[model samples]
Target: MADLTFTKSTGLLAWPAAGGQWSARSGPFGLGALPSGVYAVGRNEVTDYTTSICAAFQDGTGNGFFVPIYPGFSTTRGSIGGRLGIHPDGNVPGTAGCIGITEHDASSFHDAISNTPANVSLTIEVR
Candidate 1:
């Protein structure tokens, strides 16, 4: 399985095996930064925006953090059941509590990991 690392300090998600990296913009006011730890990428699903793909961040105990985009609406911390996931979107407003990237980057990220079997481990380190 391929391993992915996200550094909160730089808002960058790195996939060494893929030989590339992408900028991941976290929530405004630091509300979107994921807790530094190891997590698993759960089932692949479509985002609320209906134009991108996403998956859940599992805490290794059946709990999931799903990231959803509200577009023009403001997003608050824990608004969506404290669920956060990786999705496609720019580092702009309305992403107050989710990690997002440009649509192009999102597609690249999705393609890199989407084929991985479920329960693939992904480590996120917040510094």
Candidate 2:
């Protein structure tokens, strides 16, 4: 079976009014169902100042997978790296490094985030 994990790995938590799962800011958000396999999401929650966002997964001891940052939201062939990766351009108004999707596997990456009260949520799936 395929498992999906959502995470809010940065900036501010953009949630709804009633308080529920999180979503991305403005701009183009990526959406897709990942391949059937084990994956993990990680990010540093925004507190005071200074923050870095990255997503990676390790299947086994030696096998490690690193998420790539898609440039210009281009889905063209012969790009930088293989495999579908999420691409973030710019958020509402004028913000950078916001959440966005690229591959079909990243459809649920924002489901774990909460925007309202400002809270980060991380979801993980094994097998």
Candidate 3:
């Protein structure tokens, strides 16, 4: 059996604009440490101006699944500071942001996500 790990941390991340991209360094879950099909659930857009809770994951590829993990489907603005379930492959499938997982140098990507001042709660359960 593969070694599975579950780690949790708290910090903030900045969500870039449509043409921009941002990343968070969740715990010590390195780049390749997390399988390509990993899932992420937490707050996305955060700011005194805007906020949102989002859940996203991949299917062993870079294609990601994203959804509004907040109030309702119609509600698109809010902030979430709580424990989120991050699974390599969640038991059930639903609507969420699924993005292609890219394998990169762990050392380089580390601390990239939580480097922002927006403070958040992050959890990464690896399998």
Name the candidate that leads on TM-score.
1
Each prediction's TM-score against the native?
Answer: 0.57, 0.21, 0.21
Q: Provide the clash count, candidate 3.
A: 25
Which stretches of candidate 1 lie above 4 Å from their native place?
29-32, 43-82, 103-105
CA RMSD (A), model 1? 9.8
Error of 1 at 125 (Å): 3.5
The lDDT values for all models are: 0.49, 0.28, 0.26
At residue 72, what lDDT does model 3 achieve? 19
Residue 14 of candidate 2: its Cα lDDT? 29
Q: How accurate is candidate 2 locally (lDDT)?
A: 0.28
- Location of the lowest summed lDDT over 10 successive residues in candidate 3: 46-55
lDDT of each residue in 12-103, candidate 1, tens digit only: 87878767587766665446555555444444443233323222232212222233322222344345465565655442332445565533
lDDT, candidate 1, at 111: 55
lDDT of 3 at 113: 33
lDDT (10s digit) by residue, model 2, range 64-83: 22233222223342142243
Give lDDT tens digits, candidate 3, residues 91-120.
233212221122221111122332433354
